[model samples]
Target: MKSNKRIILHYDMDAFYASVEIRDRPNLRGKPVIVGTSVITTCNYEARKYGLHSAMSVAKARGLCPNGIYLKVDKEKYSRVSKQIKNLVLRLTNKVEFIALDEGFVEITDIIKSYLSYEVFAEKFKRGIFKNTGLTCSIGIGYNKLSAKLASDAKKPGGVTFIKDIGEFADFISDKGVKLIPGIGKKTQEILGLKNIVQVSDVLKISLQELRSILGYNRGEMIYEYCRGIDNRKVSSESKTHSISNERTYLSPLEDKEFIWSEFLNLLVKTHKRLKIQKFHTKTLTLKVRYLDRKIITKSKSMNITTQNIETLKKLMLELFEEIDLEKKIKLLGINLGNLSENKEYQLSFKNIENIKKERKIQELKEKINNFRKNIV
Candidate 1:
C-alpha cells in the first residue's frame, strides 16, 4: 500500500540569499549575515539565533542583532544561481515545479523506482547541488506536496526527511498545532480557537459536514481532507508563461512625481518588449508602488480589446498609475502586463481595426530595430 503512494520531493535552499552572500564572500562565514533593506529577506542561521527572520523590520532586526552584517539583496546574481540549480534538477527529472527562487517540488515517483530507495536519490541530489553551487539544501520526501513541504521544513541546513505514507504523515502531525497545516493563518487559527480546535487531532474529531459549516464549503472540505493526511494536488511542470513584469527598488525613496514616472516608463517599455518577443498580447496593465513605510498599493485596468501596442499599453498604464495615491515617498515601482493571450485573433474588434493595423506596423519597426541592435552588439 505504501509503495502505491506517489513520491514527491520538496527541496528548499537553506537561508538562500544569505547563503549565496556567504558563499561568495568567505569572510562572512560564522557571522550573523542579514539580507534586504526595508525588511529582512533572509538571514544565516547565526542571525536567526538572535530572533531575526524574514519579513521582520530592518529596524527590529538591528535592535535584535546590532552587530549583524546586513547586506542588500542582489536578485540578478541570486536568479542566475537559481537557474543553475534548476538545470541540475531538470537532469534528474523534468517533473519539477519551482514555487520560489529557492524552493520547489519535484515528483520523483518514477525516478526512485530506478534507484535503490528514495533516501539514496535524495542524498545524491543534495550532494550534486552542493558540488555544483556550493550551497546546501534540505530535501523532504513524502506521498504528497503538503507532507513533503512540511518534512523539508522540519529539518534545517542539510537534512533529508522521508514520510513514507499517509499513516506516517497523520501520526507525525497529530500532536502539532493547526497552524502547522499550510494556508491556516492567524485569522483561521483565531476562528478555530473559538471552537477549541487547536490541534490536528482536534480537527479529526469534527465531522466533515461540521467542518464545512465551520470554514465554509471549499476551505472546510480541504482542511478536513488535509487533517487525514490526504492531498490530491498534482505536481505541474507548466512551461507556459502567464504574465510579464518588471520592477525596481530604489536605494532612497523618491518623492518627485516626474522622476518616479520616468522610472515607471522605463519598466513599462522593458516589460512590453518582452511581451512582444513572446508573441503575447495583454489586455490588462497593473501598477505597483511600494512606499517608504513599506506599504504596497496596486492598481489595474483592462482594455476593451487585447493589444501588443506599447503606445496603447502606455496609455493604459498611465491610467492605472493615476488611480494610485502617490502622496507618500515611494521606494519601489513596478509594472505587470497580464491577462496574456498567445492567440492573436481571440478578441478582434472592428472598432479597433485602424489601431490594430497601426500596432502591427509599429511591431514590425520595433522588430527591425531589435534585430539591428542585436547584430551591432
Candidate 2:
C-alpha cells in the first residue's frame, strides 16, 4: 500500500432526469417514467427492470412497457437543478471535475486527512443533498479517478463504496465484464473476447506484448495499466469547454430540404447563444444527423480562425449538412461547436464585426417583441 495515496471521490446522480421528474411529481414515483420521445434519454429504475435504458427508442420502450409515462425534456429546468448541485459540490471542494451535468469527481484527500472518516463524510454529504434539493447520488471513493467512478456505480441510487488500495480494487473488478472497465465499448469487448479475455482478471494473465498486438500500442498499454488498478488521472476543476452544441429530435421524420435547412438554422442559433453565454469560441463546427432507421452520423469542419459568430457557424454547419446524404427522412438534427477556446477578447475581422452587429439587432428585435406582448397582455 502506498502511504501518499490520493483520495478521490466520484459523485453521480441516480437516473438524473428521471429522478428529477419523480422528485417534482411525487405521484410519478415507483412508476416506469420515460424522459423522451424519439430516443429514451433515461428512465426510472422501474423502467430499467423492463429493459428500458437511455438511447433506446421510445416506441420500443412503449412496446416493452405499454403503461409507461413519457415526457419531453425540460432543458432549462434540468440546467437550473444541475447548477444547484454543482454549487453544492463547490462548497465541499474546489478540486471538482464535472463529467456531465449529473456526474462529477471531487478530490477529498485533504479533507479526509484533516477531519472525519470517509464513511461519515459520505453519509453527511448524501444527507445534505436530500435535505437541500431532495435528490440522491451515489458516491465512489478510490485512489484514482477510474477506480472511484467504478466504485460509485457499484452501488447505485444513494449507495457509497470505498476502494482504498490496489488489492481491494483488483478483487472488486476481477469478476466483472471487460466492458465494465472504461474505454472498452461493445466493439472493443468483441475484440477482447476473440483473444479469450472476457473478464478483468483475464486481462491480467495476458502479456503486454499480446495486448499490444490485439489492441494497438497506445490503447493496449492504457488498458493493461487499468486492469492492474493503476490510473494516474488527476481531478481538476479548471475552466474547460471541449464542445458546446444543441440538438433536437423530431417526433416524425422530415424529408423536405428547406424545412431541414430551417431546422439547422434554429439549432445554430441555439449553439451560438450557448457559446456566448459560456464565453467560448470554437474553431470546429459539426453537424450530427440521425436517420429514421436510427443511423447516426456526424460531419465536422475546421476553420483557420476561431469564432463565435452566428453567420460563421451557420455557414460552416450548412456546408457540413450539404455533404450529408439527406435523401432519407431525418429524425434528428444537431449542431456541435468544438475545439473551444475561452478567449473572449480575440480580434475579429470586419466580416465578424458585421455578424456581431446583426446579432445585436436580432436581440433588440426579440426584446421589443417581448415588451410589446407584455404591454398588450
* Residue range 140-165, candidate 2, lDDT tens digits: 99999988999999998789999988
TM per candidate comes to 0.85, 0.85
Model 2 CA deviation exceeding 4 Å by range = 1-3, 291-300, 315-326, 347-377
The best candidate in terms of lDDT: 1
| lDDT accuracy of residue 305 in candidate 1 | 79
In candidate 2, clashing pairs total 0
- lDDT of each model, Cα atoms only? 0.91, 0.89
Deviation in Å, model 2, residue 187 alpha carbon: 1.4
